[model samples]
Every structure is written in C-alpha cells, then in structure tokens.
Target: MTMSSLTFLDRERSVAGPGYSRWLVPPAALAIHLCIGQVYALSVFKTPLVARFGTSETAIAIVFSIAIVMLGLSAAFGGKWMERNGPRKAMFVSAVCFSSGLLIGSVGIATGQLWLLYLGYGFVGGIGLGIGYISPVSTLIKW
Candidate 1:
C-alpha cells in the first residue's frame, strides 16, 4: 500500500468534508466491528479443526485464547501510539496483520504445524485485531 493510504498525517484533510453525513459513520464502524467480531465464532469449527489437525480440542482452543489475550495487550499498549499516528495508520497496520495471520495460519495448517498457527493467528493477528478493533472508536470520537 501507498504511504498516503497507510498514514493520514495531515489532520485537516482527514476530517470529513462539509457535505458529509455524521450518521453514516456509525454504520461503517458497525461493519468493521461485525467483521472483527467473527473471531468469537472460532468454536464453530472446533470439531473440524480437531479432525483436520489431529489435535485435542484444548490444543485447538489455544489459538483462540492466545489471540484474545494479545488483542487486549496490544490495545492497551498500542493505544498511545495509535493516538499519535492516527486511525488510518493503525487500521492499515491492523488489516495487514490480520490478513497476514490468516495467510500464515493456512500455511501452518497445510503443513500440520501447530506453532505456526499459534504465531500467525494468535500473536500477529491478535495485534491486528486489537488495533483494528480500536481504530474506529478513536476516529468516531474525534469526529
């Protein structure tokens, strides 16, 4: 992605134009929230994941637990940085982290390596989830 897309450093230009509708922001935020919130449904695939990976249910559940833990950690630690850098950069980074996690996790699954799955979906993706999760809240508050 281009630098402009990742970082909206210019505070003035980042603001909504005069004709913009404030009401539209909530729906947009809701869309993002809905997408991120799907992580909670990982349990739905627990049985299939167990069979595919030949692992116990507890092992598979670690992925969810780790990601959730990291989400809170990153949000708490990264908040100040996100504030300084603005939501655009945070959101972009989050998107990259989350997307990369899925890609890497796929590789891990294909190779039957549980560690890769944890690293990808838990550590890295969790960071993305945390940052992306908070981005809209900050932006909406600013608006």
Candidate 2:
C-alpha cells in the first residue's frame, strides 16, 4: 500500500504531537488488556462446550492450552515485528484477530466442530492476546 492509502493505524499517522496526552495511553492499554483477559474465563464454559461438541473435558481443555501456548509463542516472536511497525498497527491487528477468533469459535460451537475451536479461539485469539498484550506496553513506553 502507498503512503496515501495508509489508514489511521499507520504509525506515521498515529504518532502523538506535542500536545498529545500521554495519560491516554494507560486507559487505552487497560481496555485492550481487559478484552484480551476475557479468555481466561473459558473454564466456566468447559462443561457447556463439552456438551456442545460431544467431547471430553480434556479435549475441550486442549483449546485453552493451545491458546496459552500460542500466546506465548506469538509474544516471543511478534515483539520485533511490533517494534519495527509500532503499536497502532499491532493493536488493530490484535483486535481483528481477537474478534474474528470469537466469531469463528462461536460458529464452531454452533456447528459442533471441535477443530474450529482449536483454530479460532485457540490459534487466532492467541495471536490477538499476544499482539494486544505487547502493543500497549510498547506504545506506553514510546509515549
């Protein structure tokens, strides 16, 4: 994409000016964190998910395991990318991934497809978790 086509998410455009509110960073970062942290509440759905997918609790639990694993992996690997590109892009991508993951995982739940849970809430959401996590910290530091 050309510079002209760049969205607000572009680091160049997202950069704060002299009057920018550094105080705004914490609230925004907190919001992102709250959204991402919701994944931890998955255990409450374990029994329901097991019934929905006709799977054992262990199998359902694997979804959480995958998500946590991917979160770690993505954070470890995605840090440099976040550093190079800046936080706005990373957080936007993170939001998309997270929301998409929830949608996809819901579809999986609706359709009784176990793998979709693994792919959606597990893989995609985990990427979101990682990116969402790092973006704010980096951005706050920069600010």
| Clashing pairs in model 2, backbone N/Cα/C closer than 3 A | none
Taking all chains together, each candidate's TM-score versus the true structure is 0.89, 0.91
Model 1 pairs in collision: none
Candidate lDDT scores, in order, read 0.86, 0.88
Q: After superposition, how far is residue 89 of candidate 1 from its true place, in Å?
A: 0.8
lDDT (Cα, 0-100) at 53 in candidate 2? 84
Off by over 4 Å in 2: 1-6
- Per-residue CA lDDT of model 2 for 1-143, tens digit only, reads 67689877777777678998779889988998888788899999999998888889999999999999989898889999988887888888888988888889999998899999899999999999998888888877766
lDDT of 1 by residue, 1-143 (tens): 55466435443345677898899888988898897897798899889889989999999999999999999998898889888877777888899999999888888889988899999988898989999889888878877
Instruction: Choose the strongest candidate by TM-score.
Output: 2
The segments of candidate 1 whose C-alpha lies over 4 angstroms from its true place after superposition are 1-12
